[model samples]
Target: MTAFVLVAGAYTGDWVWHDVAAQLRAAGAGAHAAVLTGMGSGAPAAPPGTDLERHVRELVELVDEIGDPEVVLVGHDYGIHPVLGAAGRRPGRITRVVHVDTPLVQDGATALALVPDPAVHQALAEGPAHLPPPASREAWQRWGSTDGLDDATLGRLIREAAPQPPATLTQPLRLTAAATELPLTGVLCIANGSSIATVQSLVELGDPRFQALADPRITYLELATGHWPMLSAPDGLAEVLLASAKGEGRRVTRPAEGELPPHLRPFLLDLPERRRERVGRVDLYPPEADGPRPAVLFVHGGPVPAGVEPTPRDWPTLVGYARYAAGLGVVGATLDHRLHDLSAYPRAAEDLAAAVDLVRADPRVDPDRIALWFLSAGGLLCAEWIAEPPPWLRCVAAAYPILAPLPNWGPFEPRFRPAAALGRAGNRPPIVLLRVGGERAEIASTVEAFLAAAEGTAADVEVIDLPGGTHGFETTDRSEDARRAVERTMRAVLDRLES
Candidate 1:
């Protein structure tokens, strides 16, 4: 007796949900495909004033009219905005809220802010009041992956798609506390680069922002299809929705209370602490007998939540490595960059460059003998330095880094791929790579690709493999091999710095 309200993302309408709705109805559930104010077959061209709030009102009115005793609300992509707003207004009536292949956007966040493409940003900012839908397959890929969709469905989508109102993208979504309190389900599109494992990894980072995702009330289901699952796998999407209503999807496990996540655990190597000095946003651990010694700048990986406490500079692994480097007769520096999320890479790269400048300018460090060490997600930031090494730069090092964007990280700039950048280097600095045997397949594949790209390059590429290590192995593995790998990698970096 549960009634389902289905909402489609930008450029589509109720038509996009037709197959799913039919399947839902055949299974004895009531389904309503919502047609927003500026979309669908009979609707007029979106007016200048058509915004998010207008769409919310439309959904609210539909829910009121349906008056089903039990109601489940489903939202896909851009459709999540109105679904959240409407749920906020009618919290008591909504049984559960399902997010389909979209991020859980916070209050007052605009879709424009979450999108990573600069071209999309420009189009929404300076183009027409209503942005037109994709005219071809290439353009569609920019919006989301087109995997699993046949040519007929792709053509139908292009021909029937509606123009998106600019205000819908730019306007902020407002939500109430009661709405967030409702039971939630997330249907992740794995082929589009997100899966239950990805969500679980984020939760394991111990970030407060992702803590709520571990709550038992939240469930996750993986769809091995493209972003538009309703179009590509309608029956599967319908089944998932039904399962979601029954609270049957997998739940992400949290660390036991008072226990730290693996990344936050103490570093495996035991090293004496050195006197630490703070320089702007950088933390310096200068060697005791330093006479303008060679420096190694450590960059921590993220798309870490901006609000996460202790920050990356203070992470046990970074702190431990910095202190250990100081013990080896070099100035070791750790920096706090602005890589707060996927979209902030450019700003994060700029912050890292500035930190390098700050470190080189310090009187205790040798400006011409600096080495850069990158970790985890921070690995992509090394692409620029590798592509065009500065005369003063001596070496580049990365540990368990993502060298290429994941398949699901849609429409990324080609310049950020380290594997591709290797081909563009003229006088590249020596490269030291630390590969983990037990790393996630997605990340491990990126490292393998980078290695293949380095096959015949003039650069001196040395790889130190940890046979039984995981990503963030310094704290997670805690084995003899892990300690030795860390030591070997550090020694290799020092060799390049002192050369």
Candidate 2:
């Protein structure tokens, strides 16, 4: 299907993306663009209660009219939901969404809502009336203007700019796709030339919320052009649009069903069931069919409050999600974990060891290829596993993991050491993240915030910004940044696993 656009933000219309649209067509994509209700590129202002329907209609109409197997959807500014709503209404028709510097408003939120800038949000509401306004001048001065555009181009943009409808600004979109799954990419364009780049949270897509999109699949990109890259860096913007259509923009690995254990399948897709009194659970996968492959028994990212065992879906990077595990073709499996109340330190590690014993009990799993993917508490548990180190677990991949609250891995990173790790050589060389005073920032809170505010201010070279938020948020919808952070870390893990 054709590439579609829903112009959002600043009471603008589809005309704004004209420069981008042209480049996309040149790049071999059939593209269509729509102006949302209330704001028009040239049309006079409309009446009240005009919702995002115009934008949605433009998208849906293009999809329906094309009759293609699937289409690539693009949204600029605040068009995320309008396009997403249209996509959700007809999920099968849209192959993927290109969130081109688009604010992904799911339910009633604008891109402006993400940052704490109310004044700009208000200006945005007044629609065309407020804009080309005094405030925008500063933003424009700082980030707008094309080095190559002439007076004619400038006059047309200034004259036709429409005020954004207050209704569109106020109406919260109900992100229907939250329940259904879809792939989306949010390109963070520092159009204003702001040193920092962002997607502006439908509040921060970090670990939790994004895990819904899963990793190695949902793409994220940042561009150097000012906000209206379409007007200035049209060529570059068009390149990105073409990449979106091709599905080769950003590649990620997801789990394939072939790697899953025969018994694990029903349990993975099934609802909570009576898990027999098993010591622990070990998950696995290999590269090819019926072949021995490297497997990981990721025993981390603690479980939720409701149950004793971790539902694969509950964890931030819910283990055994076929879409996720299939990536890298790594055999990704996790035990039905027991987190809070019914759990303690040694008990979990012992159970893990037994679980490994069980896997070793099977002929399919290559014990030599086993690795431990430990998160936070699980990291410490993995340290215990290494004390005597189970014969099965060959390597350890510790993520934002807590390896005995060392004096270093703390400030905000909890360092409480479990008694089980007492007197043990806790120097396990796992691929670790937030170890307090960490060399690299774990994609966790505090760290991500630090990165956000300290845009250029130099801090500790060892002090990195962890967008992933503290370890726990990795697999949950709680933090979108954390999800990307975890995915980045996953690549590293894959590299290490292969090495």
Candidate 3:
């Protein structure tokens, strides 16, 4: 019989897995909940020196005591650190490892480093050795969404929560190569804000960090509860865990090498290449008969992985658009911004601003007649320009752009919200938005929200809808409709530029 080792996240420990353990036992599986040091009811207070390694050692000891030949090690939230450490040390005993509502942390990474709130980081850096759990029911939301928890559960959670040792979070987790070789399963709690589709989208972006997710040995399952799925839906969680042990869940397949992802396919229009010049980080394609001509600067979407080769400036669609703009008697430009990840939006905005200044300073470009075109995730960058359009900025265009952050992004800055910015704007540039019918639901919702917000604004907004197109349709959808839409969009932007 397969044995299961259940681990709970911060604060409460063995008790958190009680219900799930019961269900697992009823289903003919041996379930053991390993309570980490400095946690669980009646557990002794941890010393300042009690770190992640100590907790990992505690879990390793439990596995040794259980002495099960086939062990399915399950980790939830903060518990993953110790679980991974133990698995790395005993790879021969662990058959499969399951991660519940936690990120895939790399070796040398600390739990505190993954925490999004800067205030939490500051407090942890300067505060006591032990961090107290939430004092009030409402405060629990900081850890994760409290969507499905009942009043009794919430009350009990706060009452029984233990102080988390600061060292446990700050200490790095070290893993051996054998741990990675074990089969893995990820359980995402959608109500707390993540789903299979979200993972697929990140993988689709060609982010190298997520490339391993496509391996057949890894599987994904979703629970429609909050972060504490064991409390909210214990039976459901048990079922998923059983299914995971059997290697039954959705698996994302990676495209073969030399095969293009939907987003990287060939551009719809095949335009002739123009004279290209590298202006610092920006690529420029000046029109043939140009003497200080109007310029269109294209910003490609992505918190693209920093190591992605060829860069956004060299992408086929961006190059195609730049060349197409040059054909329209305008100076075309494409730039590489530093939106390396979700947290680097401010830096990306700064990079884009610097690129804009560089483009305007060029002697061959008409600085006062510039248009900005944004794509995909780059749409968020449009918020600043739309909120306060400079006199030189004539028009703005976006192609299947994400105007708002997805729910999974978690507590993004309000300043990056283009929809909200549009609502508060006075005078703005003419906006040309290309909407794709078959766009991903998350991205499509943002586009709809942007349009809804635009309805209340005085800013001139025009939407060109492609009834049969998908996100990144310029390359993915090779239909004649997509080609016409691309042509129409280009013409519309050029008309505004020349106006």
Candidate 4:
């Protein structure tokens, strides 16, 4: 029988793998769910002193005790850290490494460093060493049921979930190129179609952590479920594992021709009118019409990754939104701003200004009928735009934008606060806030704060509540409601410019 060692991610334990393990066991394979020391029930919470080496030792010890000459190593979430480290330490003893949900860590970098958001670090510092689930019971149920996990199963999972020691995330992994040479399979969960696109894009861009994914020995599988496939879609996950055990790679189901509506192709790479800026490039997608078209300058979220060059995968989203706008009858242009590490707040604000000037100067664009579409973190840079409302600007649209600073995002300049700007600007533009209904608590608070500050201000603030929309609704949520919300948002922007 082929032996499998299963490692769980943060706030999880062996119990989470019970269903998946049983399926593998019934298939005549010996499967052992190795609960990391600081996770699972009765396990001592790992302290700040606990590091990746500690978990590496535990996994290596477990493999030796399994008594199998070679084992298939499977890791989920943060478990990828230790699993990869162990694979580096004992390459010959492992047949294949399967990573689910989380990417393999880069050498000399902690898992925490890879997370783009600063808020996550804040939460870790303020909270307990072992982190618990952030969502409520209802939210968990809502997010987990993408694969139809029943109420009873989800409840059991919630009850059994534990606090993951923060140390697990903060500790850097010790890895060499040897692990990349091992046969690898990636079982992607959550928004599986786009997730595959993202992974493939990362591979194409030569991201160090995902560079192995491009290797001929690596295979990709999509579970089409939530992040926790073990609890939600155990049967599907187990089947993938069984096939993987035989060195079989399942064919990824490709999206049908034109399945993604034409309107959603605003950020298509093939869009015309490209120019290079100092920080990055900007692509302009003009309306198909002949005369001067109303234009909108788009800004993407992220202080993305520091020190890494930007690639198509870096801003597939902003590219898409820009395409969507142009397809709807306006000149849509997407801007790639300098990363936080390379440039600070005002620099991004300056880049946005330059993109606007470039788009306005275009003979095909109407300078008087321009607007701004800011997504996520990019919305923060719009504080200056809001504070000093331009005369020709018609409106400002933001989708799930982080309007307020939780600090630590450089200087909290007055321009960082949009609400205050809305109140002071003599010529406030109509603002359309695309609020995601199912947003998390922290983001929800930021949204409410922005709205409250905008109250009684001169700005004509309009809130478009996208029911059932996730954080990155455009790319992630394909529900009818979300699609309609996106369509409505584009029409509003185009109509404002055209009028």
Candidate 5:
């Protein structure tokens, strides 16, 4: 029987781990998760003046009672400090310790004292009192992930926060356990991810934690959710940690060296980072199901760097493109490109070319069955990449493509007025350019310029003139046109492949 010991973080108590713990117990693991004093598990927190030495001790006492010399102890968030302290003191007791996106203390320290920020100290002073009232009773809910709690469990959450005793964080200890080699698992929770700046603000001292995990030996799992991994991705979280404990399945070896995980997320595609050196590191999306598939190199317009993994919002994602390619087998990917700004050019086009290189290099992506799915400014960049003509690319499908930016920059424009932004249309790629157009004459002019450039240049140009469609016709909040757009894009890409 694998004995389990669980601990909660911050104001949360054992309540958070109820779902996960039950599952572990059922798996024949002797699971025992306890509430910290002044925390959850039905214990009220100590007053601010509670003795640090006496209170922090409850952890060791609890472990000793568990009777298991070797236990898998889980320390979530602030709970890590006490759990590790107890683990270090009784090395024989803790077989393994799992930190779910918890902070790694530089010097063994407690939560409050380690904060190091006066703003936090001030916030702690005003503390839970000054916090805004939750919109509903569920506001006080202890979260493992958004998915962790159902209606019954959520209704039972305690409304008030436990008083944080600063002594826990201030007293640093030397971890004598040479067994520090005990496995550490990190859950990278990216959902509801605010800017990196915001993440740093909360765990300012956690910079070293990120640096340490670059080693492959450390078991790190990424759940495509938010900071509250247990809430949004409870199953994903449980699956990773519990699975890690059981033993990781043989990860099918891929040719590409792994990347900056959290920063990249899911945009990971199947390509060696070295091949597209100019593009730096990219996230490739491989086909999810077992089937040969038509492929597309997706380009999205963003001044900020796109992450490596696909986010939930990246709907009709790389995998979606692969899955929906007119029942034709399709593997797809999107790439991150460096950019100064939107109005800026040349840089975006350069990044698109790098994406093309990535697609061509991926073994699973049928080299000749690939297309370009570009939106808005991305369409402009795609047009530019086509000019260079990566050997593998076969077709292009652009959505609200930006062309002749100077002349036909808006809803109104004459159809043949030199395409406002066609300054260098002649230098573009010779592949087929499939444009989904609207009623706007500027789009017409843009199409005309693209057509004129391809007139005898061997670049096949096809236009789907959407009746009464506007610049952002199908991309709006899923109107009938949006449905049609998805269907049309799917049909067109498939037709190109099937033909």
Candidate 6:
């Protein structure tokens, strides 16, 4: 049987993995949950001084006891540190490593480095070694991403949680090149607000805490649930974990049109014919017209790592935009570029070029009248095309895109700098900016800078400020304000394409 070892975060014990362990066992695997030195019934009187080495040693010992030549190490939250450290020590015995909503710490770095804020770090550091459960059931529900926990599960969880050692949070991780060589997967819980947006910013900033994820061997898996998937989404988490262990998590397979949300069903159409093999896939939405018709390529913003495969849940907004374009009598295709961290940059541009070529060659598409609609990070790919317009490329639309990079996230690439390219471009296709009113300060500033750069350009530029709409307003926010912005932006794009 396959051996699976599970580790829980600080202030928690093996009980947190009860459901996942059970699921693993039923799937014909030998599952074991490691109870750290100062946790649970293992040693109630043990002080909170249990440090990193103890936890790593305990994990290594557990693997030895399992008597398996290899095992998959699954860690939740802070558990990632010890699990990674143990894996480094016994690289040959660790077949795979999985981190659930926890960033990997750099060698000689404390896991607390992953905390986004220093205040949170201070709180965790000064707290009692074995932190107590939330004061009341209501507070527990209100705590970070635990709102999804049912009453029964919450009760069991409250009873089982033990105060963790403060040393565990204080100790730094010690890992070498060996840890990076292990097959790694990150299961991000989106409901906790740990979305792709957060990961993108981290990777762009070159944050050391996320270095492991940025490596070529790591695959990203997303769960749209809360922080603790074991209690909130055990079955789903189990399926992903099993897939990771079987080394299938990185394989890319296009989602069937039927598998998409009901609202996206009507816009489905066959892909454009290609002479040679294509670099990426596109979800086509042909217009209702019989003869050739004007078409638009819809690109969604994502800093999906270079080699990692994007799951269906990864880009739902792109589907919404493609369908919206089709509704306006324009053929639309949503393209998925190479997303791995190793291949995303210049590769995305190549993919976009290939997509444009495919659409131009399609008999159903009007090659000379094609337009480009880019959203978020997708705008980065448009710098070159916009700077040097193709005779057939019509207009270009950028919706709440980060036209420039933030200090935290440096430039994507020198050529991918949209703001710089805007100033250098001569007369080209008309450009439209769909500015969101409620965008975050940093991103909004970048958009503002781009708008400023476009002011003196020879190209005809238009900016429509979408009032009361936040970032991703079209797909994520369902308010009347968001609805109006979507309608206005689509109308703007349609007018430009027809003009």
- What is the TM-score of each predicted model, taking all chains together? 0.81, 0.44, 0.84, 0.60, 0.44, 0.52
Question: Candidate 1 on 1-499: residue-level lDDT in tens?
Answer: 8899998888888999999999999999999999887888755667778999999999999999886788899999888889999999999889999999888878998877655455667887575777878899888877776778999999999999888898888889998898888899999887676778678879988777887788888999988788889999999999999999998899999888898977788999988878999977899999987489999999999888877778888889999999999999999999999988777889988999999999999998899999999999899999999998998899999999989877657666776889888999999999999998987765776798899889957567999999898878888777888999999999999998888
Candidate whose TM-score is highest: 3
List, residue by residue over 1-499, the lDDT tens digit for candidate 4.
Answer: 6888998876677778888999998988889998677777656667666767888998998887877665999998778888999898889889999987666557877877644334457778885555556444554432222234676876776777775667778877878678868888888764322255445434433335545556678777776666678888888989988878777774323234556422233332234543323324567877777888888887876555445554322355666666666777788788676645423777878777888988898898888999998887677777888888788899899988878653222235677777677777887878888998876433565678789878867457878888787666665566677777877877777777777
Off by over 4 Å in 4: 42-50, 114-120, 123-154, 192-194, 205-211, 250-336, 339-350, 357-367, 371-498
- The count of residue-pair clashes in candidate 6 stands at 13
Q: Which residue window of length 10 is worst by lDDT in model 2?
A: 194-203
lDDT of 2 by residue, 400-489 (tens): 553432211212112223223323424332333432222222222323442343334322112223543432333332244544555555
Per-residue lDDT tens digits for candidate 3, residues 363-451, read: 98999999999999999999999988899999999999989876446567888999999976777899999998877665777899899
Off by over 4 Å in 2: 6-8, 42-44, 67-69, 103-112, 120-136, 139-159, 178-180, 190-214, 251-499
How well does model 6 score by local distance difference test? 0.70
Per lDDT, the best of the predicted structures is 1
| Cα lDDT, all candidates | 0.88, 0.49, 0.86, 0.71, 0.51, 0.70
- CA shift at 39, candidate 5, in angstroms? 1.1
lDDT of 4 at 101: 63
RMSD of each: 4.0, 15.6, 3.7, 9.1, 16.8, 14.4
How many collisions per candidate? 1, 60, 0, 5, 42, 13
For 1-499, candidate 5 gives per-residue lDDT tens digits of 5676777766567767777766776666676768666677587556654433544478778878876545776776667776677777777766667766554554455566433224445655653332222233333322223333455544444353454555544456545454365666555443322222223222321233344443344455555554445544555666776766764522211124443222223321222222111224344555444645557666664333334224312433333443344233465566655543433456666666666667667666666667777754455665444544444455667765655442202122232122222333444332433354442433445566666766656455565545545543332324565555556665766677656
lDDT, candidate 6, 1-499, per-residue tens: 5788988875577877788889988998888889778764564455547788888999988888887665999998778998999999888889999988776667888765553333445567566555454544544433346636788877877777665566776788889789878988878776555555455445533334454445567777777677788888988888889888877654212224346322223222323331222224766777666888888888766665444334322344666666667767888777777644523768878878888888888888888888898887677777887788887777888888867644323224667877788766766788878888877554676677777777756567778787776666554466666666667777877787777
TM-score attained by model 3: 0.84
Candidate 5, run of 10 with poorest lDDT: 407-416
Q: Give me the runs in candidate 3 sitting further than 4 Å from their true place.
A: 1-3, 12-31, 41-48, 64-69, 134-161, 189-211, 214-216, 223-239, 252-257, 260-264, 288-293, 362-366, 406-412, 437-461, 465-469
User: Can you give the lDDT of residue 299 in candidate 5?
Assistant: 67
Q: lDDT: which is higher, 2 or 3?
A: 3
Clashing pairs in 3: none
Worst 10 residues of 1 by lDDT: 111-120
Once fitted onto the true fold, the runs of candidate 5 whose alpha carbons sit more than 4 angstroms away are 51-56, 108-120, 125-155, 158-161, 169-179, 192-209, 224-238, 247-499
Candidate structures ordered by lDDT, highest first = 1, 3, 4, 6, 5, 2
Model 6 CA deviation exceeding 4 Å by range: 41-44, 115-130, 136-143, 195-214, 251-499
lDDT of 5 at 405: 41
